[model samples]
Target: MTKRNTKAKQLILNLLKAAKSALSQDILQAQLGDAVDRVTIYRVLNSFLEDGVVHKIVGDDGKQYFACCKNCSDKKYQHNHFHFRCISCGKIECLPNEVEVKLPKAYRTLNFNGVVSGYCSNC
Candidate 1:
């Protein structure tokens, strides 16, 4: 299904595209401030996830963060790189390098969420 480009969707897309690191719903809410409602934001995010416009990252604190997808599609969604979480700033970033994981025979790999925690270069 072709998703209509709404104002809310454009706003969220711009925010995600300009973000250096993954952003949480709270951050988006604070940034948007009264421009968009919480429920609308949630729906927009869910649609973006389904459309492969963004990818979700679950932090160590159990908060969901979002970032623009570099290589994803509606048919096949996959994140082959690792997410780096800064220990000092608690910021999550999607690493550009792709990771290859080897599994035992007869085992099938599904979703991958490999996170590496450490102090970023700026920290």
Candidate 2:
């Protein structure tokens, strides 16, 4: 699902990479300041998701958040870290510290999600 390199796609990728946290499509579109149409945004996002360029997460409030993948080609990041959601501001971001989950011996680790919800610094 790789998209041909285009100005719109590059813009979107750069924005996501520089973003401190995940952003909803609405927010992302708004940030674009009408530089791109909604349809193009969706197309690009869908392609990026399929290509492992980004990962989508559903927050506690049921809102979808999208963040850029660090190295999703092999998907090693799929189970590496946790996410933090700000209940007050409704912003979601990846937590810097790794979450520790103790498992029984011989238990194989697979895909998992760890979430920590609270107020962010600004909220």
Candidate 3:
């Protein structure tokens, strides 16, 4: 399925695609220049998140960052990937490989929460 393109959405999408890694709102705004506003950015982020066109990488600094989907044509992000955070520089990098999360056979009946965070080589 394909989505109808809008100017603001395209701008936000391009910003994510060009980012080195996950980008904070300030960085995105700076990168986007005067083309959009914070509210618009927030809305676009939320919409993209719902549509799976982007993914959020929460940083230890208590800020949410965003990354682009490499396969953007699919309108969905592969959920099995991991994101690496640099402790010293506070940069977030997406792991090239997928990380599998499987519950134990005995615990499969229970609901669980999972999140993985750690320092990367850049730290």
Candidate 4:
């Protein structure tokens, strides 16, 4: 299904595109202020996820974070990269390198979400 280009969606997309690291819903809500409602933001985020415009990452703190997808589509999602979380700053970022894991002969890999937590370079 085709989704409309609403102002709230555009704002959320712009914020995700401009973010250097993955952002949580709370963070996005705080950044958006009174312009967008929480329910609207949740709906837009779900739409983005369905459209493959963004990918979700689980933070070390157990919070769900969203980041812009570089090479993803509605059918296929190529997210073999690892996510890094800064212990000092509590920031989550998707690393550029693709992760390669060798599985057993009969094992088939589906979705992978690897998180590495440590002090970021800035810390």
Q: Whose lDDT is greatest here?
A: 4
- Compared with the true structure, what per-residue lDDT tens digits does model 2 show for residues 1-123? 544799999999999998988988888899997898999998888888777888887777777678998746784455457889988877789877666677899986765566679999997
Candidate 2 regions off by >4 Å?
75-77, 97-114
Stretches of model 3 off by over 4 angstroms after superposition = 1-4, 72-78, 104-123
For candidate 4, which ten residues in a row score worst on lDDT?
Answer: 71-80
lDDT of 4 by residue, 1-123 (tens): 666899999999999999999998999999999999999999999888778899889877898899999867545756788999999998899998997888889997767888999999999
Residue pairs clashing, model 2? none
TM-score (C-alpha, index-matched) for candidate 4: 0.88
Summing lDDT over every window of 10 consecutive residues in candidate 1, give the lowest-scoring window.
Answer: 71-80
Candidate 1 Cα errors over 4 Å, as ranges:
104-106
| Candidate 2 structure, TM-score to reference | 0.76
lDDT of 3 by residue, 1-123 (tens): 786678989988987888788888888889888898998899889888878787777766678888876665665334566676776676787777765667677653221112346665665
C-alpha TM-scores of all predictions = 0.88, 0.76, 0.72, 0.88
Give lDDT: candidate 3, residue 65: 86
Clashes of each: 0, 0, 0, 0
Which runs in model 4 stand beyond 4 Å of their true positions?
Answer: 103-110
